[model samples]
Target: MKLVVRRSVCFQGHQIPDQEAACQQSYGPDLEYRDLMRVTAIVICAALAGCQAVPGEGPLASAINEDAGRSPAEIGRVNAAVFDIVDVDNHTARLVSDYVSTALKRRFGIGGGPGRAVIGIGDQLKVTIFEAGADGLFSTNDSKQATIDVVVQPDGTAAIPYVGTVRFAGRTLEQARQEILASLKSKAVEPDVIIGMGDTPSRSVTVAGAVNRSAQIPLNLSGEQITDVIAKAGGPTSQPYESYVTLVRGKKTGTALLKSIVENPSENIYVQPGDQIFVTRDPRTFTLLGAVKSNSRIEFGANDLNLLEAVALGRGGNDETVNAKGYFLFRYEDPEVVLGLLGQRRFDELARKGMQPDKDGRYPIVYRFDMSHADSLLVGQTFPVKSRDVIYASRHPAVDLTKFLRVIGAPVGIAVQGAAISNNLSD
Candidate 1:
């Protein structure tokens, strides 16, 4: 006795209609429903497992997954000073001003003059004596004049005829002339003297490194500036923006960009004797990574390199896969500056915990630029990219979703095929 059966299925709450006309060989209706439900449940479970296994798979899987556990706010709270690009640029301008002011003060002091030029031993002097009388000691005829070449002695005196050994070292040219005139007043009748520097051997500034010609430039009464000495050495061989000019005067030393020294009058302080001016090609550079068209180290070509220019240097802005809102620039900034930028309450909380910068006097700082906003273009224009900075553009959400879907497609396909095969066999 053959039992007539109809093929019907119920999945979750939805029922499939029965083929009543077909009285096929029986796979018991209750058993078939149980089997279908079991297959459906297995497929759903497999799909869920596949999703769980591939959670980290995506186009941005490598980049975003690394920090998946930390949200933006949580990451910011962990001792990393975060700011918008616009605020960062404004603060950086203040920082540059402070640096310039400090550099000027260090090199030039309160007054911008080069100060007095003191005579020293080993310096040559051209001394001219004039006599009013025809029969005077220095007179050969009616034009009564005598010239003598003198070198400052180690004991700070210069030997002269009838004037004995006079102390002239450590005195200016005018002072030396007065001393010589007083000494000769007792010897020659109505003697007058004029002292001028012939070749200054002891007072010189050394210009070295990256200049076309490195030399020891003499410091004269003209009070030549740093730029003047550098120019005498044939100027800098490297690009001004890429070069750094360091001034070492006695125990004090200061460094600034060559471009800054050229553009800012205060920075072109007078060069003092014994000052060492070094111009080096210490080019500032930043790293471009993540969703940029090209990832590499980019040197700053200008004195002020804004975010837009930096992005362009890295082979144009971010690619299609980038998240416009997730552009980031990482740097090390002064701790005090970071705190000042954060303002009162947040700074107080962080300071209370004794959060200090490292030995380099820098704290880790991160700046976000939301390219999604139209005003961000202007912000990018003003935002400066400092040396050793890292510019990163994060991947878009769609990239992750597409990657996940691609990763799970095979498993899901297999599950669907299995369900279809089970249905066919049951039918």
Candidate 2:
């Protein structure tokens, strides 16, 4: 039988202040307090083995630097949008109901298929009284005046005069008319009752949590596919959709993948009645603050992001102006802690590949890849990206912030003194 041990160390490569480094070194590597380097060596060895000899994706499970081959990247950049959530408390519902009503009017008779289906307690129904003649059963009143209120009965069915106690609560108008005809055949001699639904019913699906537009998606049975529902409520606003659309059906919640459903036809599932679709945004993003083209938070694609891809999103590096050699990554120091929760096989492979820090402190626990390697097409394909890794491209040594401030400060001071003297003379 083999035994396994776990370890962690917080490594910061930025050379400490002279005062702190001298103080820490004087404490000596003896007392238990000096655990940073002692513990780091074990993780360093794990990380080295990973960089040099690891084969396959299994070993470097949490190594964010691994490449995903050439297939996914070639797809190029598509729409990188995010969704926001909306609640159906009371006031918003009315606005949605009115909008859906207009949409239904335009959609009528355009498609041979059934019109949109909507659900709400107070939807209206168009009931026309037609007297049979040799020609046809013409409407007694204008189609406008014949519209009637759909009332709920004690038994749950809606009430109508000629078609008393017709069951229309849960059923669509089409389904309700079929039930009404079945009831009338038993009483009148071959009665002719024509029914049509007025306006799209005002039913809603609640969109809650981290999306861009989280509002109720007005439903019509005519509408199908999860995308149709998302489109109805405004699509995601950010790049590369993160999180997922969750369908909450009572106590049971099921997940609908955003990419697979959008990219693949087989995965698109239909929205059911009383279903709540929620889109959640991801908090895991690379924070690139200094000396970059677009200094903003870049949220990585959930599955396919590596070191090179992260830089590419920021329009790559402007090495001609800034120093590319100073580029580095910052993340939670202990990669093993996060890997352990992912899978056991993954953890062992990461350890064996030296992706975990070495038992003898040398390089960082994480790999430091050179962006220059991307010049070669083969090497670029070999690199992979992981979620939440922060990439920072440091300023060139020749250009220093401290020096720039000192050079500018003298001129501004001289100008200020001259202005003060001139102002005193004017006064």
Candidate 3:
């Protein structure tokens, strides 16, 4: 329906006497006065209408639906190389929510029991020799026992007073003592030996990056796990979930979140000799885009973040602009996880529709969750927000109506003010 506005005429602050005759009277003698006012109203209306056109284009989901590929009709819809939109449901939420980080646990077995505590090359050891007779090698007439500090050489041997060079590397402290006793028995007078380990350079795990103190933590005879060494070096400087611990043992390396190690004890593996640990802060975050109140990148924080929590973090959707049914989460899903979840037949059908995998073997996917229904809300509560995920709140169809009314309102406001003035000169 065309917009119609009616209003009573007033002069300054008071209603004009004989309002009908006063409105009919001319404002000026200029023959061009009434025509100028009428032309101005038409110009303002056209400008406002043109301005609303871009913003009034329908909901974002409509645009995606228009360009959709013929992916498996059952496996959901795909927009080809751009993205794939899947309306999340209860069954899909159950399967996708099961996705957890097993990066460290899968590669390195969780059952990392106590490791060997053998003396390595370059280890420091204090050896003491005791003899029944005073006049003997490594002992004076005044003292029965003689103590010497020695380092395990790179060649896996240590030099002694009478034993020449003894190999201590790969031997337990007690075992090394026995070997030394045998060597001293042949030289020193009735000698007994004792060997003790000290702080060593080779048998230590180096802890650095995002820790209170970056240092080399010495391994004791008992055992030192990943957490033990991190605590010794003054723990992670950031939140446990935000902290990632990378363990480099020899040529192999494995990384796990500090939260994972604390929550799952089996993940806290024993540190080996010469192991290097790196503690880095990597906050898990997702981008909230499109018709949200505030477009931003928010952290997942110390716990798992769900779709509902993420929407709150994005300051919820703009009610005037966003659709109740159009929130989409964009992610490059691992083809293996998705294919396994979808089963081979459905995925094969999707591939046949020309929706190919990317260079990283990942499929570009968009998961749409309608917030209008109670079931969708419950399903969204279980759906997880992953790191680097993008959430786009699509525009509402009413946004076009809202903008169109705005354009109409501009012309209406002009008509209400000029109705009397324009009617007078037209006659």
Candidate 4:
């Protein structure tokens, strides 16, 4: 049986006539037909969706999916820190929406209607006329960009033309308009005023740090967020891999992680005037131990240090006699962070067994060594050092003690002998 279709009229002056209305009114009778129709519609929607490309499935997918490729140098890392156009998509949408809303309110003369009283500032005003055609404050240029300077008196009223001095600063535009029109009945035939933003520069936020650039981002009716501020400053520099950013608002400061704050819309706090955003750099650090002039920490601007380079940085052993021997390198790098040149099989075996080598491997090895040997120098060159590595060097006990006696005891012996001879001559 063919389904009788009728349309019905819903709210807001929309018409749903005969066929549609009849179906709704008799849904009990048309239940099977309606069910079929709903199923058909869902199927059609699914078919359409199947035909369409999914997000990140098309040509642009490659670009979007590509991780900020491995940065080999500090310069490359810094370049990667720039925020892409896609990152600011939400900010763009919000700004457009807010600006459109502001424009609509202004165009429709919707001066915050009654019960929603607007606010006003010093020299601020709201001019309106119940009788119409009596709005006359500045009409010469008729330009919306009118500039008439007036002080907000101690009584909270501003001195204006025709109406003399009237309190308006703290009141909403509508409130000020009504109050002024009431007071102007004796002076002029009509009175109305419109309050607006002043010519003074609005409040802005400043972003600074390991960013490509830094600037003060302005605020319109459409506000911005921390991410927007970071983008404005050219994003965070990858050299430091800013795990989190810090924002200073007056005396108080808050820290936000890049991932958490960006992904969660609720936490994306609206930036305020005078807010300072600092994008931090990755804490650069390298480790040093073993036989070196300075067995301490070394820092880098970038994430890099060669095994030999780090040892050299540590002055590579103290006295000429104590050269680095059987150099041992300890690294805190990821277990999977592979080194291209290093023998992977050997390295992995050593890593898995937690076995470190000594000078001799035939029998129970005596791992300690004297730096005076020439072979130790070559060992120092090959042993690789990594981030946060500890280079431990076992010194030969005999060599250390002998060098110490030469360095200290001999000098004291000569001084004592000379003193005794002088005493004998004096006697």
Candidate 1's residue-wise lDDT over 350-383, tens digit each? 5454444555556555676667788777667766
Winner by TM-score: 1
Model 1 / residue 280 / CA error / Å? 1.3
Candidate 2's C-alpha runs over 4 A off are 1-123, 133-147, 152-155, 170-172, 186-190, 199-203, 208-214, 240-244, 254-260, 280-304, 311-386, 389-427
Best by lDDT: 3
Distance from true position, residue 201, model 3, in Å?
0.9
TM-score of each model, in listed order: 0.70, 0.41, 0.68, 0.32
Candidate 1 vs candidate 3, lDDT winner? 3
Off by over 4 Å in 1: 1-111, 316-320, 334-340, 344-363, 397-427
Candidate 1 vs candidate 2: which has greater TM-score? Answer: 1
The whole-model lDDT of each prediction reads 0.67, 0.45, 0.72, 0.43
> Which tens-of-lDDT digit does each residue in 56-116 have in candidate 3?
4333566565444454443354443544566789888877887555656666665656767
Give the per-residue lDDT digits (tens) of candidate 4, residues 1-427: 2333222323244443435334432245445745644533432232222222222111111222232122224224433321111111233223322321121122223232122222333333223333333243433333322344554555767765666777754565566667766675665434344455442122467888777898777554456766777887788776432346777767766654454456555455666656788877645456665445686788644333444566677787545323233344433322222222224674554334333332311111111222346654454344333334555443322233233223322223222323323222222
Residue 121's lDDT in candidate 1: 85
RMSD of 3: 12.9
User: What lDDT score goes with residue 197 in model 2?
Assistant: 57
After superposition, which runs of candidate 4 have C-alpha atoms over 4 Å from their true positions? 1-159, 163-188, 198-202, 237-244, 283-427
Off by over 4 Å in 3: 1-59, 62-87, 130-144, 184-192, 250-253, 333-336, 345-364, 397-427
Which candidate would rank higher by TM-score, 2 or 3? 3
Ranking by lDDT: 3, 1, 2, 4
